[model samples]
Target chain A: MSQERDTRTAFMEATYRALCTHGYADLTMQDIADETDKSKAALHYHFDGKDDLFREFLAYLHEGFAETIADHPEGTPVERLVALVRRVLDPVDDSADQQFNTAFMEIKAQAPYREGYREVLRRFDADLRTEVADLVREAIENGQYDEETDPEEIAEHVLTYIHGTWTRAAAVGADVVAMREHLVDDLLDLLVDGASVPVDVDATEDRGLAAADPDEPHENSSEDVVDPR
Target chain B: MSQERDTRTAFMEATYRALCTHGYADLTMQDIADETDKSKAALHYHFDGKDDLFREFLAYLHEGFAETIADHPEGTPVERLVALVRRVLDPVDDSADQQFNTAFMEIKAQAPYREGYREVLRRFDADLRTEVADLVREAIENGQYDEETDPEEIAEHVLTYIHGTWTRAAAVGADVVAMREHLVDDLLDLLVDGASVPVDVDATEDRGLAAADPDEPHENSSEDVVDPR
Candidate 1:
C-alpha cells in the first residue's frame, strides 16, 4: 500500500481502539494518538478535526460493511440472507466487536442530526433494501416465492426485522443470541413458503400445513395487493 | 388536581416545549423556564436539577403513553393492534405532535447513555410487548388465532415492526404516512390468518385467498412449531 494510505488506515484503527475504550461521548484525539505510535501532531496533520475524523471513520466502516456483504456469496438468497444475519448476530466472544456494535449504535443515533451521517445512513439502508429486494426477485424467479410479492416491501420487512434487532440490542439485556437462533428461520418462513429452518413453528405449523396442502403456494404478504389509498 | 400535581404537570409540559426546540443535546434549564410562566427558581424548587426534571418528563410521557393505550379499546385484538399503530402513524398534521415525535426519538436515542432514559425506555418497551402479548392471548381464547401460536414471539414481531418504523422516522426524509397506510394490513396478515382490513389487500390477496382456501385453516407460521432452543 502507499505510505499515505497506510497512515490513514492506521489512524482509523487507532481511532477504533480509542473509541472502544472511551466511547463516543468521551472519545478524544489525544486518546487515539496515544493508542497509536503516531504523535498527536502527526494525527492532526491527516484530518481537520474530530468531526472530520469521525466522518472518515464512518465512511471506512461503511466500506467495510459493503465488503463483508460482497465477500459472503455461497448460498441461495434465503440461505445467504440468513447467513449474513447470523454472522452479525452471533459474533464470537470478541469484546472489541461488541464494543464496536455499541459504538456503531451511538453513531447511528446521530443520523438525524448530522448531514454526513444522514447521507451515509440513507445510502446504507437503501443498499441493504436493494440487496434484499434482489434476493426476493431471485426467489420469485426460482418459483420459491409468489409472483405477486412486492419485492420492495419484502425488502423493507427484512430490513425492519434487522433494525428491530438493533433496537433491542440498544436496550438493556437484549438476548441477541437467543433471538438470532429463531429470527432467521422466522424470516425464512415469513418470506418463502415451505422453505423451512430449524424453528419449532416449522415442525408444528409449517410442515403440518405443508403436508395438509401439498400444492399450496407462497403467501403474498398482503402488501402486494391493491392500494385503497 | 392538587396544586403540587398541577405544578409538576405544567413543568413537564414546559420541558417538552423546550426540548422540541433545543433537542436533547443543547437543552438548558433556562430554556425550559422561558417556555413556562414559572420562574427558574420555582422550577429548581420542584426538582433538584435537569436530570431529575428530565426523569419526571419521561415518566409523564410514559404515563401518557399508557393512557393512550388504555383509552383506545374499540376493536378485536387484531383490529385494536392495527388501530394502535394507525393512530401513532396517522396523526393529524399538527406540527407540535410531529415535533414531539422527533424530540421523542432524540430522547430514545439517549437511553443507552442515560440511566433514567434507559429505565423509562425499558419499561415502555416491556409494556408495549405485554399489551400485545395479552391481545394475542385473547385472540387464541376467542378462536380468532391458532391455539398453539406463541404469543410472545407474535408480540415481538409486532413490536419489532413498530420499533423499526421509529428507527426509520429518525432518518431524514422518512415517508411514515405512506408506510402507515399499508403496514397495518401487512402486520395483520403476519400475525393472524384470514383477518381482513380496510387496506386493498382485503380486496386482492387476503380476501381473494380467504375465498380460495375456505378450509386451509390458520397458518401457525412454521417457526411456532418446535422450540429446540
Candidate 2:
C-alpha cells in the first residue's frame, strides 16, 4: 500500500509538472510520463485514461488551492485579505498561478454539466469562501470593519471579483498584471474597513499628470470615458 | 448561399435546443439531429465536427447576448441599469437566458485552452462591458452618477460580479434569485450616486431579525459567523 501511495504521488507530481509545461489542451500522456521514471504502462495501470488522470489531477489541484486558505498568511485581517487577493487574483508570478487559473477555469467551465467536476469545485469553492468569511468576521470583531459589515456578503463580493478576474483573464488574455495593478487590486483596497474607495482619486490624479497613458481606462476626461457612437 | 444560410440557422437552433435540454457534457450529435429534420450527416457536412459546430453555435449565442446591449430598453439610466442587470443576471425563465448562460459558460470554460473559444468570448465580453460602461457614462452625463465615477472601472466591476456569479452558480447549484435579490442587485444599488451601500443595512437588518436563517453567514452573532475554529 505504501509503495502504491508513492507511485500515486509521483504520478500526481509528474502530471502537475507536465500540465504547467505543456498546458492542458496540448498536454499528451507521454508529457506526464516523461516526468516520471515509470513507464507509460505503469502510468496507464494507475489511471484508466486521460480523463481519469485529469480527475485525480483535479483533486490534486483542489488540495493546492485549498491550502492557500488553510496556510492562512500572517497579518492583520486586511493584510491577510490583501495577500489572499494577491495569491488568488494578482499575477505576481510569470505564469504559474495564471496558467493554473486559466487551466483550472477551463475545467471549471465544465462544472455545470459534469457532475464530477461540479462536486469537487463546489466543495473547494465553498471552503475558500468560508475562509474569506472567517477573515471578514475576524476583522469585524477586531473592529477593523464596522459591526454592520456582512462577512458572507463581503466574502462573496471579494471572491466574485477575484474569480471574475480569473475568468476574464483566461478568456481575454489581458495583461493581468497591469489590469490588477492599475485597475483590479483597488477592489481589495475598497474593503479595508475605512479605506477610501478612490472613486475620484484616479480622475484627479490622472488629469494633473496629463502625461498619464492615454489608453488606460478608469481615469480620463469624463467626456472620453465612453466613446460617443 | 441562401440555402446554406437556412441550413446553418436550422443547425444553430437545433444546437441551442439540444444544449439547453441535454447540456454541454452530454450533448451528442444525435441530440441536435433529433431536433431538426436533417440527418446527422447534414450537421457533419455543415461543420467539420463538434468543435466546428460549437464555434458557429457560439457566434449565434453572441449575437443573442449582444442584442441585449443593442436593444437598449427605454427608461432612466438606473432603471435601464437594473433592467440590464436583470437581463444579464436574473434567471428569467427555465430556458431562454439562464439555459443559454449555463450552456454558454460550459463552452466559455474551455476558452482558457481553446483559442477559437477565447477569441469569440473575448469579443463578446468586451462588447458587453462597453455597453455597461456606456450606461454608466450616460448616467454620469445625465447626472445620475457623480462625475467622479469611473465608467470603465465601474463597468468592469459590475461585469466582474455578474460573470463571477455565473461561474459560481454553475459550479455550485445556488439560489441565484435570492442571491441576486439579496446580494448582486445591491452591488448595482451602490452605483446610484447618492444611494447607501447596504453593507450596514444588511447587518443591522439581520441582527434585528435574529430570526434570519441561522445557516446564513453574515447577519448572525460574530461567534456564529465563524464556527469557533
Candidate 3:
C-alpha cells in the first residue's frame, strides 16, 4: 500500500481501539493521534472532527463486512450465510470488539435526535438488510429453500437476532460466541424447515384453539385431537 | 395506605423519574428531592445517597416484574409465559418508557465496572431465569411440550431475545410493541416445532461431506444434500 494509505489505516485502527476503550462520549482526537503515533495536525488533516472520524470508522467497518461476504466461498447459500454469521461472532483480541459494539449501539441510540447520525444508521441498516437478503434470495434460487420463503423477512429476522444477541450478551456478561452459536442454531432451524405443531389438528378446528378455554369443550373435538391421555 | 408508606412510594417514584430523565451520571439527591417536593434531609432519611436510591430503584423494578408474573392468569404454562412476555413489552407512555429503557441500559453498561450495580443485575437476571424456567418445566410436566426441552437454555434464549428487542427498538426509535409482536411470532415458531432442516441427511454422510469441503462447494456436488435448484 502507499504510505498515505498505510497512515490512514493506522489512524482508523487506532481510533477504533480508542473508541472501544473510552466510549464515544469520552474519546478524543488527541487520544487517537497518540494511539496511532501521529501528530494532532496529521489526524486533523485526515478527518474534520470526531463525528467525521466516526462516520469514516463506520464506513471502514462496513467495507470490512462486505469483504467478508465477498470472500465467502461458492456454496449452498445457507452454508455461506452460516459462515458469515460465524465469522462475525468469532472472538477477537481483548474486549475491543465488545467496546466497538457498545459504541455502535450508543451512536444508534442518539440517531433519532441527530439527523446526520440517523441517515448514517439508516443507510448502514439498509445495506445490511440488502446483503443478507441477497444471500437468502440466492438460496431460494438454488432451490435449497422452499418456494414460499420471504428473503426480506428472513433477512430482517437474522439481523434482528444478531443485534439482539450482541446487546443481551453485553447486558448479561455472557460469552458472546456461545450465545451467538446458540442463537444461530435456533435461527437456522427456523429458516430451513419452518415451525411444526406436535399435535396434528384439523386446520379449521385448530385455528383459534389456543384462544379458547381449555375447559370449554370444542364442538368438533375428539379424544385424539385433544390428547387427553 | 399509611402516611409513611405513601411518602416512601412518592420518594421512590420521584427518584425513578429523575434517573430516567437525567441519567445516572447527572442525577442527584437534590434533584430527586425537588422532584418529590421533599427536603434533601427527608430524602437522606429515606435513602442514604445516590447509590442507595438507585439500589432501591432496581429492587422496585425487579419487584414489579415479579408482580406482573404473579398476576398472570391461570392457564396452560404457555399462555402464562406468553403473558409474562407481553407484560415486559407493555407499552406505557413512550416518553416515559423510552427514558426508562435508556436508563436501564445505561445502568447495565456500568454494571461490569460497579460491584453494587452488577449484583443488582445478577439478581434480576437470575430471578427472571428462575421464573421462566419453572414455567417451561411445568409445561413439560403437563405434556404441553416435549420432554427434551431444557428449561434453562430456553429461558436464557427468551430473556436474551426480549432484552435484545428492547435495546434495538430504543436504538432505532421504533414501536416497541410491534417489535415485541414480531419477536414473539418468530420465537414461537422456533419453539413450537424445532428448527427444521430442508432435508434430513444421514449423520455420518453429512459429517464427512462437511469436513471434505471445508470451504463451501458450489452447484452440484455428490454430497449436496439439499438441491438448491
Candidate 4:
C-alpha cells in the first residue's frame, strides 16, 4: 500500500510537470511519461485513460487545497483569512508556475463538459466557501468584524473576487498581487470595526505583477500549447 | 459584398446554434453545418477549418458586445453602469442561455491554448474595462461618486468582479442575480456619496437566483458536452 501511494505521488507530480509543459489541450500520456521514469505503458496500467488520469489529478489538487486549509497556522480569524488569501494568490513569477496555472484554467474551463472534473471542482468550491464562511463567522463572534456582517455573503464575495482575480491572472496576465492588496483593504474597510484590524500585508514587495504585458496575447514563450492533431 | 456579408451572418448564427447544442470540446464543422442551410463543404469554403471558424465567431461576439454598449439606453453614468451590469448578468434562467454560457466558458478556458481565442477575449476584456472606467470617470466628474475614487482602479475591480461572477455562475451555478444585488450595493456604498446616487435597482423581482441549488454539480438537464472521440 505504501509503495502504491509513492507511485501515485510520482505520477501526480509527473502529470503536473507534463501539464505545465504541454497544456491540457495538447497533453498526452507520452508527455506525462517523459516527465516520469515510468513508461506510457506504466501510466496505462495505473489509470483507465487520459480522462481518468485527469479526474484523479483534479481530485489530488482538490485534496491538497483542503489539506492546506486544514494545516493553516493558528491566528486570529482576520489574520487567518488574510493568510489564506495571500497563500492562494501568492505571485506567479516563475514560468513553470504560470504555465501550470494556464493549464489548470484550461481544465476548469472544461468543467461544464466533464462530470468527473466538474465534481472535483464543485467540491473544491464548496470547501473553500465553507472555510471562508466559517472564518468570517469566527471573526464576527470574536468581535473583530462588524456585528451585522453576513459571513456567508462576505464569503461569497471574497470567493468571487478570488475566482475573478485568478481567472484574469490566468487568462490575461492581470496584476493579482496588486489586486490582492485592494481585496484585503476592501474586506477590512467593509467588515472590520474602526481602528481594529492592522494592515499587515507588505505592499513594498513587488511580486512579478510588472513582468508580463497585460495586453499581450496568451501565447507566451514558455507556455505554448501544441496542436494535438 | 452585401450578399457575402449576409452569408457570413448566417454562418455565425449557425455556429452559435451549434455551440449551444454541442459545446466547444465536442464541436465540429459538421455540427456547425447541421445548424445552417449550408452543407459541410460550404462551411469549408467560407473558412479554413474549425479553429478559423471559432476565431471569427469570437470576433463576431466581441463586435456584438461593442455594438450593445454603443446602443445602451441614454442615462447618467451611474444608471448606464447599472444597466450594463444588469444586461450582462441578466437572469440566465433559460436552459438555452445556460447551455450557451457553459459553452462560451469552455471556449474561454481554452483561450490560453488558442491565440485567436485569446486575442478576441483580450479585446473583449480591454473594451469592457475602458467602458467601465469611463463611466466611473464620468460619475466622478458629475459628483455622483467620490472625488477620491480612482476610475482605473474601480474599473479593474469591477472587471475582476464581472469575470469572477461569470466564472462562478458558469462553473458552480452560483446565485449571480442575487450576487448582482450585492455588487450594486457594494459599488453604491463604497463609491457613491451619501444619498447621492439612488439605488435604482428593483430588488423585489426574483431573477432565478433562487432556482438552482448552489451546491449542485454543473451537469444539468441542459448543457451536457458530447465527447467527439
Candidate 5:
C-alpha cells in the first residue's frame, strides 16, 4: 500500500511539471512521462488516459492546497487569513507559478464540459470557502470583527477577490503583486480594526517577496514591519 | 460594402448561436454552419479555420458587450454601475445565460495559450476598466464619492469582482443573482452615500429579473423602491 501511494505521488508530481510546461490544451501522457523515470506505458497502466490522469492530478493539487491552508493554525484569525492568501497569490517565482496558474485555469474553464474536472474543482472551491468562513467566524468570536459581520459574506467576498485576481492574472498577465496587496489591505481595514492588529507578513517567508524586484514600489510598505522569521 | 457588412453580422450571429450550443472546446466549422443558412464550405470561404473564425467571433462578442455598457449613460454613476452589474449577473432564464458564460470562460481560459483570444479579451478588460474608471471619476466630480477616492482602484476592484463572480458561477453554478445584489449594495453604500442615491433598477429592464422565480427572497429589496420605467 505504501509503495502504491509513493508511485501515485511521483506520477502526480510529473503531471504537475508537464502541465506547467505544456498547458492543458497541448499536454499529453508522453509529455508527463518525460518528467518521470516511468515510461508512457507505465503511465497508461496506472490511469486510463489524459482525462483520468488529470482528474487524479487535480485532486492531488487540491490536497496540497488544502494542506497549505491548514498548516498555519498558530496565528490570530486575521493573521492566518493573510497567510492563506499569501500562500496562493505570493509570487514565489513569477514564471513557474504563473505558468501553473494559467494552465490550471485552462482546465477549470473546461469544467462545464468535463464532469471529472468539475467535481474536483468544486471540491477546491468548497474547501477554500469553508476554511475562510471558519476563520471569519473565529475572528468575530475574538472581537476582531463586528458581531454583525456575516462570516459567510466575508468569505464569499474574499474568495471572489482571489478568484478574480487569478483569472485576470492568468488570462492577461495582470500584476498579481498589486492585486494581492489590495486583498491584504481590504481584510485588514474592513474586516478588523487595522491599527490594533499586527498584520505583518514575513518578507522571507514562502511567498518569497524578498526575491521580488527591489526597485518596484511596494505600496503597502507598512505591512512589511519586519522579517517575522 | 453594405452587403459585406451584413454577411459579417449574419456569420457573427450564427457563430454566437453555435458557440452557445457547442461551447469552445468542441466547436467546429460544421457545427457553426449548422446554425447558419450558409454551408460549411461558406464558413471556410470567410475564415481559414476554427481559430480564425473564433478570433472574429470573440471580437464580435466584445463589440456587443461594449455597446451594452455604453447604452445607459443617462443614469447616476451609481445607477449606471448597478445596471451594468445586473446586465452581466442577472439570471434572465438562468440556463442559457449560464451556458454562454461557461462557454465564454472556457475561451478566456485558453487566452494564455492563444494570442488571438488574449488580444480580444484584453480589449474587453481595457474597455470595461476604462468605462468603470470614468464612471468613478464622474461620481467623484459630482461629490457622490470622496474626493480622495482612487478611481482606478475602484475600477480594478469592481472588474475583479465581476470576473471572479463569473468564474464561480461558471464552474460551480453559484447563485449569481445574490452575488450581483451584493455588488450593487457595495457600490451604493461604499462608493456613494447610500441614502441619497435612488438605487432603483427596473425589473422589466433588459436584465429580465421579472423572469426570475418570485418565491426567492430578495435581500436588497430596499433598493427596489420603484421601477421608473
Candidate 6:
C-alpha cells in the first residue's frame, strides 16, 4: 500500500513539472510518462485519463495549501494570515510552478462548460475564503482588530488581492517573490488602518484633465512615477 | 477608399459578435469571415491572418478606452477614476470586445514567447499606472489630499484592486456592475482613511489554535461572519 502511494506521489510530481515546462495546451500523457520514467500504461492504470490527472493535481495543490495553513506557528492572527499569503506566493526558482498556476487559470476560464473543472475550482476558492475569514474573525475576537470588524469582507479583500497580485505579476514578469512581499505589507496596512479620509480636490482635477483626452499623448512626465521595484 | 474602410469596419463588427459567442481559444479567421458574411478572400485581402486580426482588435480596444475616458463628463479626479473603473468592469455586450479582452488575457498568460503581445500589454499596464498616478499627484497638489500622500503608490494600489476584482468576478460569475459599485465605495473609504492600527492579541490566540492542526477538522464555529455585499 505504501509503495502504491509512493508511485502516485512520484507521478503527480513529474506531471506538475511537465505541465509547468510545457503548458496544459501542449502537455500529453506521453510527456508525463517520459518525465516520470513510467510506462504510459502505468499512468493510465493509476488515473483514467488526462483530465483525471489534472483533477488529482488540483486536489494535491489544495491539500498542500491546507496543510501549510494548518501548520503555521502560533502568533497574532494577522501574523499567521500574512504567513499564509507568503506561502501561497512563495518563490519558486523554475517556471514550472508559475506555469502550472497560469495553466490552472486558463483551464478555469473554460470552466463554464467544463463542469468537473468548475467544481474543483469552486471548492478551492471557497476553501481559501473560509480559511482567511476564520483567521480574520479570530483576530477581531482577540482584539487585534477593532470591535466592529467584518471578517467576510476582509477575507474577500485579501483573496482578491492575492488573485490580482498573481495576475498582474504574471502579466508583467515582475519577480513574484518581491511582488508578494509588497502586497502582504500593503494588505496588512489596509486592514489595520481602515479606509476613511478627506478628498484631495486639486490633485483629483489634475489627474482628471490628464486622462481627459487619451488620444492626446503626453510625454512620460515624471521619472519617479516609474515602478522602481 | 471609402468602400475599403466600410468593408473593414463591417468585418470588425462581425468578428466581434463571433468572438463573444466563441472564446479566443476556439476562434478562427474562417469563423470571423463567416460571421461578417465576407468571403475568406476578402478577409485575407484586408489583413494577414489570425494574429493580424487580433492585433487590429487590440488597437481598436485601446482606442475605444481612450475615447471613453475622453468623453466622460468633467468631474473630480476620484469621480473620473471611478468612472474609468466602471467602464472596464462592465462588458460592452459586444462579442468582439469580450472575446478580445478574454483573448488578450489568454495571450498574456503565454506572453513569454509572444513579443508582440508582451509589447502591447506592457504599454497598456504602464499607461494605466501613469494615468492613475497623475490623478493622485494632482489631487495632492490641489490640496485635496494630505501633503504626505504618495500618489504613485496609491495609484498602483487602486489599479491592483480593480484588476483583482474584475478577474475574480469573471471567474465566479459575479455581477460585474454590482462588484464595481462596491469596489469604488470600498476604495474611496480606504483612500480617505489610511491603513494603520495596533494589533489585536486575543483574537490571534483563538485563530492560531483553530488553524494549528490540519488533521483535525474543526466544526464551523462562527456564524456571525456574513457577506458584506
Highest DockQ model number: 5
| Per-residue C-alpha lDDT of model 3 across residues B103-128, encoded as one tens digit per residue | 67766665554557666677767877
**TM-scores of the first chain across all predictions?**
0.80, 0.72, 0.72, 0.83, 0.83, 0.74
Clashing residue pairs in candidate 5 are none
For each candidate, what's the DockQ?
0.24, 0.24, 0.12, 0.27, 0.32, 0.15
TM-scores across all candidates? 0.80, 0.74, 0.73, 0.81, 0.84, 0.75
TM-score of chain A of 2: 0.72
lDDT, residue B209, candidate 3: 9
CAPRI-style grade of the A/B interface in model 3: incorrect
Between the candidate structures 4 and 5, which one is better when assessed by TM-score?
A: 5
Model 5 residue runs over 4 Å out of place are: A191-195, A199-229, B92-94, B191-194, B199-229
The numbered model that scores best in TM-score is 5
Q: What fraction of the true interface contacts does model 2 reproduce?
A: 0.33
lDDT of 4 at A26: 75
Candidate 6 or 3, higher DockQ: 6
Worst 10 residues of 2 chain B by lDDT: B203-212
Per-candidate interface C-alpha RMSD?
A: 5.3, 7.2, 9.6, 8.0, 9.6, 8.6
| lDDT, candidate 2, B1-229, per-residue tens | 6988988999999998888787675688888999999999888888888888887888888898788667655665644665566566655356455556677666765665554877778777788779878877777787665665567766666666666777766656555544444333343333433542222233222321011232333232233211131
**What tens-digit string does per-residue lDDT give for candidate 1 at A1-229?**
9999999999999999887776665677899999889998998999888878888888887787776555554555655655555654553256665566566666665565665877777766777777767876776676555666667766665666666666676654466655554455444554455654332344224311112221121222121211112
Better of 1 and 6 by DockQ: 1
Clashing pairs counted in every model: 8, 0, 6, 0, 0, 22
> Per-residue CA lDDT of candidate 6, range B120-216, in tens?
6666666777776776665566555445556666656556666666566545544455445444443344233332111111222221111222111
- Indicate whether candidate 3 or candidate 4 has the larger lDDT: 4
RMSD (Å) of each candidate, 1 decimal: 9.3, 9.3, 14.5, 9.4, 6.7, 11.5
lDDT by residue (B1-229, candidate 5, tens digit) is 6977888788888887877788777788899888878899988998999888889988998898898677664567756766666765556355666778878887887877775888999888888888878877777787776665566776777788788888888877777766766556555544433324543433212111022222221433334432222
3 or 5: which has the higher DockQ?
5
Q: What fraction of native interface contacts is shared by candidate 5?
A: 0.43
DockQ of 1: 0.24
In model 4, the runs with Cα more than 4 Å from the true position are A191-193, A196-229, B191-193, B196-229
